[model samples]
Target: MADVKKVATRQSYGEALVELGAEHDDFVVLDADLAAATQTGKFKAAYPDRFFDAGIAESNMVGIAAGIATTGRVAFASTFAMFAAGRAFEQVRNSIGYPHLNVKIGATHAGISVGEDGATHQCNEDIALMRTIPGMTVIVPCDDVEAKAAVRAAYEMEGPVYMRFGRLAVPVVNDADSFEFEIGKGILMREGADVTIVACGLMVQASLEAAEALAAKGISAEVIDMHTIKPLDEDIILESAKKTGRVLTVEEHSVIGGLGDAVCAVLAEKNPVPVKKLGVNDVFGESGPAVDLLHKYGLDAEGVERAVEELLA
Candidate 1:
């Protein structure tokens, strides 16, 4: 069990891949020209022979990963979330998802956290895109510990997996040995009845902060880390919605069809409530610090708190 200190989820994925590669030779690493940025360079250094640098061609890289998976090799393709889900959609859909191949797509620089590079680099639509693909397992770890666990889990699991991570260092929320990662289970971070805050990725930290703010004002907000967006712990979400009359969905992605939409869909069919979505709001991000961009796009802790307040009112 490692310490539960603050660390970026991307770093956890990079470090875990190296450990997994050292243990399993069949575990191969692939990168689409952004090895260093995506942190797959660590695995490349550890296992040079098993690492393949596809060099800027994300689509080709996805196809190669799918090909490798068919050969009984567990292939992990690392790239920015935008390219992995958006640019390599068809390859992932036909080559990987359709076949239900054991291909782990570790998409770093996900959401508005890949700030300074602007909206082009940020992947606000990755969840919606990846979740639409059949047999695809979409996961966004809440912290570094969960990130490491998700990486190991994805490697052992059989199917096309999309594990999303961010570029910036986030507050570590999960204890290394305290919680175990489950494919379709939603972890309850904090419990309340005033409202439920369902969040993923870096926004999990924001959701925690919002819960704390709401607590100060006597508004108890239940915080559920909805890491697996595809399977989506619908039971937990519905239960929370039933307890709380209002629900708030938070993510670093777009509000259109991402985490917010997925939660809304479940709530609409199961337990509908006054759900408020906090995210990019259909606007493109600009070049700035990751934290600044989060604030600008209304995905930060302050924004989440405001949304909760609005819904409560």
Candidate 2:
């Protein structure tokens, strides 16, 4: 056990926005009426003048963010994943992606881990939706440390970015000061020869735990945090798949058009291998505890271990 502290990525996003605001005067934030839930309220409190509450109109908010970006400001639009990536998708695609504006979509409450909010609130297709845009960059940070780093990187990186965040309080897997975050680069957490587990968002911690359990059963599992979903790390996936001979992708999103499909696409072209994907499996989430939903949907540590065992069998 790493004695890791737990924190929601949304909390880290708010804190990071405040820090980035201090560092860059051109940084501006926009929210579509869910500031507190999205944790953009913290940024609004610190820099009230720089924050814009678009009042429930997600499409308008995204358009406003794009307009701000044209004025040479880095606009961070915060809202729930469903609304930001779903309700306002057209605006995001045309206003932000089409123009290639420097707008960061802070999409929180993503995946089945969104808990009691249920299917309407949970978004399992944001990555699939965002990655379709030509110049859009999709990032799903594993923990608070990575979320903060991802926010800073999104600000620095030009063009539109959709960074997914979950509501569940996940274990902090990386040291804040020590971990280095780079766009489109994958981090190989555990090295093994038997199999490889590639994951993103909260599943990274679960995959790490599953790796530890697999180790006890004489099943050596390599764990890689494929944090940047878009621009999938082909080299790392190819290298690991070549060494391990098998790959298992775990995510909180749908099995279709997400991390699993992304990794399989890379492997199918470069180094084809037997791969199994664990995710929501084309179902809508219901109201329940976040942890319970994870277990029910097979996105938890135990579920991952079972998937790996089956893959090796």
lDDT to native, each model = 0.89, 0.94
Please count the clashing residue pairs in each candidate, in the order shown.
Answer: 0, 0
Q: Which model scores highest in lDDT?
A: 2
Off by over 4 Å in 2: 1-3
lDDT by residue (72-191, candidate 1, tens digit) is 999999999999999999999999999999999999998888888887988788998998998899999988889999999988888889999989888888877787889989999999
Tell me the tens digit of each residue's lDDT in model 2 across 55-141. 989999999999999999899999999999999999999999998999999999999999999999899999999989998999999
Worst 10 residues of 1 by lDDT: 1-10
lDDT score at residue 28, model 2, on the 0-100 scale: 91
Give the least accurate 10-residue stretch of model 2, judged by summed lDDT: 1-10
TM-scores, one per candidate: 0.97, 0.99
> What would you estimate as the lDDT of candidate 2?
0.94
